[model samples]
Target: MIYWSANSTNSNQQSLSGSNPKKKVHSGNANNELEWRDLEDYPLNLSQQEVMIEEGKAGSSWGKSEINSGYNSLLSRTLQVKGSKVNCFFDTEAPKILVVDDHAASRMTAAALLAMEGYEVIEADSGAAAVVLVTQKHPDLILLDVMMPGMDGFEVCHLLKQDEHTRLIPVIFITALNDRRSRIRGIEVGADDFLTKPFDRVELAARVKSLVRQKRLNEDLDHAEQVLFSIARAIESRDPNTGDHCERLVTLGQNFGEYLNLSRSQLRDLMWGGYLHDIGKVGIPDAVLLKNEQLTLEDWEMMQQHVLIGEKICQPLRSMRGVIPIIRHHHERWNGSGYPDGLKSNEIPFLAQVFQLIDIYDALTSERPYKRAFSPAEALSVMWEETQAGWRNPELMQRFTDFIHTYNLK
Candidate 1:
């Protein structure tokens, strides 16, 4: 039948549907299906939603008993679809989806439906709780109720999208209202999809499956980028002079981005840029690469080519698109003085700007064999001199210095 179910006896068995309610429909008993009346006329809309959400309403009597039986179309009549192809994103790990609804009865119903569809369901009763849960638990998907009391689904989605930690999580708004304005509002607030009240059980299950699959694919992409970064960092470590350069610069670039209040995507790109900015140096010859002395003009040009090399190396990786700018443009000065392209002022990528400043700062403060390291304050002063000499952005440097002092970053 159309019911999605997994046998409870086999925990290792991965199935698209949960076994309990789905089992009732598929157990071949026919008695459970017989017990379920046709719900074709059930008005799945806002009033029914208010009844479930608000106490002392006309349809408040709708309970879990009704929800469990609401959608069990015959398998023979179910819509046929091709099975998903297994790829890097397809894995045995079951995705966790957070279901947020102010009404417990309604929430339990949705959770049961999703759980039957082979997803691990995490439940939250309110919008505020969902926000906190999203920050701490980082669920792969959120099915949020639009009718919460204090912070509604739209507000919760907005808040989560605004935070770097939770921004990547996909949001699907579940609402009783099917109006054009409500749908538009949900979209404006960053919702990926919408599930109207009294939704078709099959449609609901399909939507959940689609989003969870997409999220898993995204996770695999993230994993790929992580692997690429590891390889790049390993290459960087070949030079004895690196000494925590990538990690420390990542911290500083992230801090500066935070101080500037950049968006989550901007901040995340900076972090990636920090790790892979020197990735192309892996291609440079050691003679010029490890040299501590001032570079001759030829050596300098060869060294600068590392930027172009780094960009080319990462160009093929679809997942590393965000990181390429930092890798290639981190050396570009504000006044068109730095290599490799000498992109001036705002022409430089914003993320590259943040990374470049910290890249220089970290080098200045880190102790080297030929020269003593500058203290944090001294490092800032030296960097300020670069700003004055048109080697860096004067305004951005001023803000970064302010952030350093305000946060007491040493």
Candidate 2:
């Protein structure tokens, strides 16, 4: 017979053995106190026989088949046995499901079903409660019910989707309303899927699994983007004169894209390009990159290779496909006098042209070691001269000029 102890402060330590099995032994902190509970009365049976002992914040699993088979599992996979005052070790891999329904019966039913599948389940009685739980717990998936008393599922989904942090967590509306209008509205509010009342166990499981998988993939992509941005920021840190250049470009490019009524995809590309456009400079030597004077012919050639290198570095990520053109062609001139490809007007990508305008404006306005910062009017005049000299797109230049003046972005 296996015996579990709680709040045992006896300083004696003993190993589990057949001959000298002690009634109680403390392995962790003496101050830790876990509530005494019988494991046999627990609901679910865990497949594994290991008992996890949590000491303070750290935890380790001990006792294989030696643990009593009659002991069932806690909500987590491992049977938690705290020594005086210890918490349980939470299962990080388990997918957390939030079930939102005003009706207690419906919410309990869904929560029970999910718990049976080994998923950690959270319950919310109303739409507002669901939102609060989402922020607090950040569940992997949400099973929502429609026709609630206060904020309905539609409103909840809408609010979640509008926030960038919560938007990606997949929401499945499980309501009695199977009308086409309801489904359309659900889709509009960014519901990943829908299930009519009395959702089939098999179907619900399949949908949840699929959406959760997709969410994981999106998380991986986001992680990759963050790494790339960190590298870009590090590269920028190499230049003392370019303070917050990437951030400035992102803000300006986003504003310009919005002013031009560009598509959302295009705006995203512009934002990414702002950080990644000069990322190729990572390949350039300090002599060329940090030079305060005009570049020598050899230095200029080496500097020009950065764009190509940046494009190559970013090409493997499928999400960067839209920004590749800006990375590669932002340096190209309208009159074909630029470096690398030297494509003339119309040959250059429009996004690249838009970004190039922003880049040039920022460079002119910001002080560099080689040149003093120009006033807004002076910068505009210089850009107009470049446009007149067939080195820039006149129409885009005109619109950008208007955008700057309208926004008073100095």
The model with the greatest lDDT is 2
Error of 1 at 28 (Å): 14
In the predicted model 1, the residue pairs found to clash are 1-75, 4-17, 5-17, 16-117, 17-116, 18-116
TM-score of 2: 0.76
Give the 10-residue window scoring lowest on summed lDDT in candidate 1. Answer: 73-82
Best candidate, TM-score-wise?
2
How much is the lDDT of residue 357 in candidate 2?
Answer: 97
lDDT value, candidate 2, whole model:
0.75
Mark the regions of model 1 whose C-alpha exceeds 4 Å error after superposition. Answer: 1-173, 178-192, 258-264, 285-288, 292-301, 316-323, 334-337, 344-354, 384-390, 394-410
> What's the TM-score of every candidate structure?
0.59, 0.76
lDDT of 1 by residue, 61-163 (tens): 1222343242221010111111212122446655667888876656756754554444556677777767766766578889888878888888999998888
Q: How close is candidate 1 to the true structure, as a TM-score?
A: 0.59
Instruction: Write candidate 2's Cα lDDT for 1-410 as tens digits.
Output: 12233333322232222332442333353322122222222332221122223334212222222221332221112112323111122224667788888765556456544554555667777787788778877988999987788899999999999998999899999766547887888999999999876656567667877787788789888888888899899999999899999999999999999999999999999999999999999999998999887889999889999999999989989999999999999999999999689899999999999999999999999998778999988999999999999999999999999999987955
Question: What's the CA RMSD of model 2 in angstroms?
Answer: 10.7
